[model samples]
Target: MKVVNKGLRAVAVLEACKGVVSLLVGFGLHVLAGHNMRQFAENIVSRLHLNPAGHLPSIFIHSASSLTDARMGLLAIGALVYSLIRLVEAYGLWNGLVWTEWFALLSGAIYLPFEIYEMIFHTSLLGVGAFLINIMIVGYMAHSLFSQETTDNQI
Candidate 1:
């Protein structure tokens, strides 16, 4: 039970961190929507000393350059929504709510396909690590849920 509590807290922290990052991204998109996105992206590339013609940098610049204010605003709203959901889930998990285990399991499982696709096609160390971490979290949640169910049934 102590180990289970620790695991739940750990996952809660992870979810909270993700929520904070999404919130920051939402704010950043909102701010950038009113500015010259092309110039902003170029500045980032220059500051990072990245070659503008490089694959990743070029894609970043092109994507930013093509975004309209409306689209950027829409993306900001989407990020905000995602952040809220994650934050709420984190709160519930931190409180050890049974429903949150189900929510976390479902939400984490949803990303498995995308993560697998990333590992197969993109094949980056970061992508692989993310996939592994997500799998572990989902596995833990599943175990927690089923173990509780078995215990209750036995009782």
Candidate 2:
């Protein structure tokens, strides 16, 4: 309710929404595992006008089609945990908590190395955008945290 920065508010809202979507996806994956994945993949490919033999498409189809109940369960549990963390961070940030800002910075920085590695090995526009956005978020939060400390010291 006291988010002073528009950018921070937007990030908080986005994170909350992302968490919700991730939760839904995890549940969907669990439910879909009981269905005929090959048929589902074929339907998706046809709907998207994708070639079945294309490397990325084929890999996706193969991976999805081969998912087991245990794997899907584990994935769902992980997604739920991730979603909860994101939601908590979003709530704290929205309330303008300084500790939440620090948490965001640390979390975002933790992903930088992995993102960089992904860019080096499997570069894509979406990946680049994700990396850049994360960097910006972390930089902005860091700047805000330090600037606030400096201002407080001066007072």
Tens-place lDDT digits, model 1, residues 64-116: 89999999999999999999999999988998888888999999999999999
TM-score of each: 0.94, 0.88
TM-score leader: 1
Q: Pick the candidate with the highest lDDT.
A: 1
Whole-model lDDT per candidate: 0.93, 0.86
Displacement of residue 134 (Cα, Å) in model 2 is 0.8
- Cα lDDT tens digits, model 2, 53-133, are 999889889987887777878888888988899899898888887778889999999999999999999999999999999
Please, what's the RMSD in Å of model 1?
2.0
Query: Which whole-number lDDT from 0 to 100 does residue 74 have in model 2?
Result: 89
